[model samples]
Target: MNLPKKAEDAHAALAAAFNTGDVNTVMSMYDVSGFIVPEPGKPVSGAEKFEEAIKGILSIKGKMEIKTVYCLQTGDIAVGRSEWSITDGDEVKVSAKGIEVMIQQNDGSWKILIDHAFGAEASLVA
Candidate 1:
């Protein structure tokens, strides 16, 4: 699969890949040095660790959808926000907002540097 040419494209690609239930295709969106926040506060780095979390979701057999809220690009880096949801038949399985950070590679393809899957959740007051 080809990497995204724009920041918003990354979210679209990810949703499409997730819907396919192909872990390899979904994993290709991330940069080698990237890390993903699978949970609210727990960050997972490296391919092996993040792959497990992705697989868990794919196993749910739900269709994923993403709507880009906004994307700002500066130089070769970009940051985006999106609203996403997963659905099984007529029922919604999961719905959330996320933040994605991406960097454009030498080939001009954007790869995800940080994927905060539930980043938009409200934070607790201290």
Candidate 2:
């Protein structure tokens, strides 16, 4: 799959990838050095780590829905705020807000740099 050119496109692509239950496709949106805070204080980095973190979600067998609340871009960097949910049929299994930083690569495609999946909830708990 091709990388997303814009923030909204990234979210759409992510949702599509998640629905397929393909971990490799989901990880394609992240940069090689990208990291995600899978929980309150623990941050997982690199492709291998990310794959491990994402496996649990895939096991649930659901489709993802994401809405980009806002995105601000400057030069090659962009910050985005979004709300996302994983649903089984009409029932939501998990929902959360996220804040992420994306970097525009040389090819002008956006790849996630830092993904704080829990958003403010993580800090509140810390």
User: Which residue runs of candidate 2 sit more than 4 Å off their true CA positions?
Assistant: 122-126
TM per model?
0.92, 0.89
Name the runs in model 1 displaced over 4 angstroms. 123-126
Model 2 CA lDDT for position 13: 74
**Residue 120 in candidate 2, Cα distance off native in Å:** 3.2
Taking the tens digit of each residue's C-alpha lDDT, what string does model 1 give over 14-88? Answer: 888887788899888888588898767788888898898788778877789999999999999999998888998
- Which candidate's TM-score is highest? 1
Clashes of 1: 0
Candidate maximizing lDDT = 1
Clashes of each: 0, 0
- As a TM-score, model 1 comes out at 0.92
Each model's lDDT comes to: 0.85, 0.81
